[model samples]
Target: MTDLLDPVSPDRAESFLTDHFQGVLVRPGDRSYDEVRAVWNGMHDRKPELIARCTGAADVSVALRYAVAAGRAVTVRGGGHNVAGTAVSDGSVMIDLSLMNRVDVDAGALTARAQGGCLLRDVDSATLAHGLACPAGVVSHTGLGGLALGGGYGWLARKWGLTCDHIVAAEVVLADGSIVEATEDDHAELLWGLRGSGGNLGVVTRFTLRLRPVGPVHHRTGVFPLADAAAALALYREFAERQGPDLHAVATLKIAGQQDWIPERLRGTPALFLTATWFGESAEGPEHTAPLFATAAPDAVLTRLLSFAELQALGDHGEPHGNRYYTKSCYLTDLTEGPVGQLLDATREIASPLSAIDFEYLRGAIGDVPDEDSAFPRRDAPYICTVSAQWTDPAEDAGHRAWSRRGVERLAEWHFGGAYVNYLQDEQPGKVAEVYGSARYARLAALKRRYDPENVLSGNQNISPAAP
Candidate 1:
């Protein structure tokens, strides 16, 4: 029989959690509660009644089981870097896994086993020391757990694959408080679901990732006036298609910031930018990138050789924490003049100067993955567009959100009928099904029944078991 606590009275909740939880237990009034509950996105200013800091898998199991017995839900926080701010829930036991970040790299086998609390920087730093890498997200501060579960997209995505593709195994704690090792041969469906399931199935405590050989990479950037966007983007598409997997790139529509590479006059002005990274020998970078300059000479250009770790952190400054963030993402069937024109119009209407409109080129290794092997959708989609709305003012929330949502609404016609789970904002439950499609969602729902049937872990882009 379960020691289910009184739903009305929580007098004994503290004593019971403190006695059972092996790690630190933080109350609402605790000094670190505010800090611990805080997540990357400033939009979510929530407070969980209890913050159970877990040291390892054993501790996480205790927290999940405690939440059930205490008649409350639980939310897990890895690096707490998700834009959706799904880590903390109101009046729930916020399982703080940030303390469990530890990575072990096997250079000989080209593999990295990282704890779920680990950030992109943790695996990048550890693996880079051995001249190897686990392809991950662009922001180093982003959590490895959420990124992998949702589908990791980074500079090396074209060269290698999404971070989830590198995941060979994982140590996950289920809603029922049972720990299972998911891999190809054992619990195969669970592992398949984890590739892009968006944390709907379990609290993954550890991940064993397959690493790739990567070291110093060369990067080149060309900033163009808004007037020259169509030409530059056309050239960008051709270049990305022509170049081999060793080349990875994207086209961004953003306001010029205070970067040394950017001219002072161009600062705060909207510009179309083309950026690419060469994963091959740094010396051969210029030859491959010369064509990018041929289409339209940039207003200014900057090129540099960066170590894998350094390149991973380049975008960190742009995506600062404690800022209101709302984003809508969709994969485009094509990047024709229509989509490009709409993108430019959207960029001009950005309510916040920090906001950006991005076109990320997909395919290459991302498309090479067999569909049956993982649950990630639209791997074959050639382009993914995201409208990022960032602001600091609470007064203009309505305006900023309206602009951001409308920005995506403009491109509805070109949508490839799929969405990336990682970039999705706080949409309705039906949106989750729409992203995965009926066929794939059905498969995942059947698998959900095996693990989290009751949906104890239903905080994220949930995959409901009872869905039709």
Candidate 2:
């Protein structure tokens, strides 16, 4: 193995990756630099020293070697959808994986191998063609690399579990430029770390995810006036407890938007939205969704039956690229009166109409995996509260970021578990350890020491190799 921290001259960094790399190299002044470096969150405007658009795992290994030898901060870019904008660091060598997007599904085995650069839409479209699906994040455009490596939640989460759970195997490039295929029989611990610990351990080049049969599903949305939210919540609590494994439900509070169902006068008003999906059979969907439409005195209501792939794309409209985004989230032991009320109240002070707060009920298949089964923690947490800030003006950046933080801070009393890594934007010192607790963080830290001892992959939701 080569030394991970050997310092080569800065002048040779571009040449190093190009010498043996089978990918295109993008420079700062290159015509495509601006476009290639752009991430989903408009908040990040980083200019990397070099961009290696890797075509395969071989290119990933070489990119890491160049970053290591050149002593540059190395960041990896998949779909570039992370809210934290960790993909492009200042003066770093970006291992760009956007060109490696290719999904190969084995119809016989019911498994799909997606490259690091694949977005959720890439995998969803591919698997659905074979009449199979992989449970993943709600946004179809979300990067498979980040979502699978962190923890994925979606309409299918209730029946199939998180996207990370389906990742049976992966090709990872270590800090020292060594490639390893991680599966049950080889580097099993590394695979565990990849399951939920973020990409802190290594650069995952490809993921083999197990697939299940999925098809057209049911979806319903009931919008209630903010004043009547308390009553809606009470009904939702009862309705949620009665849900089966095929039912996935979520409650969102946001400013009402212009839609046919929503009266023009109520368009700008704050309202509570109840949405549900039944992933079983299209014929069986309405029965599961009836209660969602039963809420008394809803301001507006709409229901639809669409394919699982289509419902996944539904959220894409609300979360478009080029919006400045920041998020703060925490896992709740349960969604009780206190936390729910507080979370709802926090939304009233939104800095942007695009901002929204979501309360997701966790049930069913997610708990099927033991806490020790993978690096993902808080499997027992019953709810996750996400306060997201989305706006365009950079002048109000501090205020928006602070609002998101304060929203989560107010729930500190009810935040019984560490946050969901996928929804996190920032955490104070010692918080990363809190994400896994002492035992699991220690295990992950030890593994980090073995694979990325120099902490070359540090930043964002960082896991220090040093003993926790």
lDDT of each prediction vs. the true structure? Answer: 0.86, 0.87
| Model 2 ranges off by over 4 Å | 1-14
lDDT of 1 by residue, 53-116 (tens): 8998878877887787688877889988887888988998898899998999999988989999
- The TM-score values for the models, in the order shown, are 0.96, 0.96
Which ranges in model 1 have alpha carbons more than 4 Å from their true place?
Answer: 1-16
lDDT of 2 by residue, 199-292 (tens): 8899989999999998788888888888888888877877886788988889998999988888787789888999888887788888888886
Q: Go through the candidates in order and give the C-alpha RMSD of each one to the true structure.
A: 2.5, 2.1
Total backbone collisions for each predicted model: 0, 0
TM accuracy, model 2? 0.96
Among all windows of 10 consecutive residues in model 2, the one with the lowest summed lDDT is 1-10
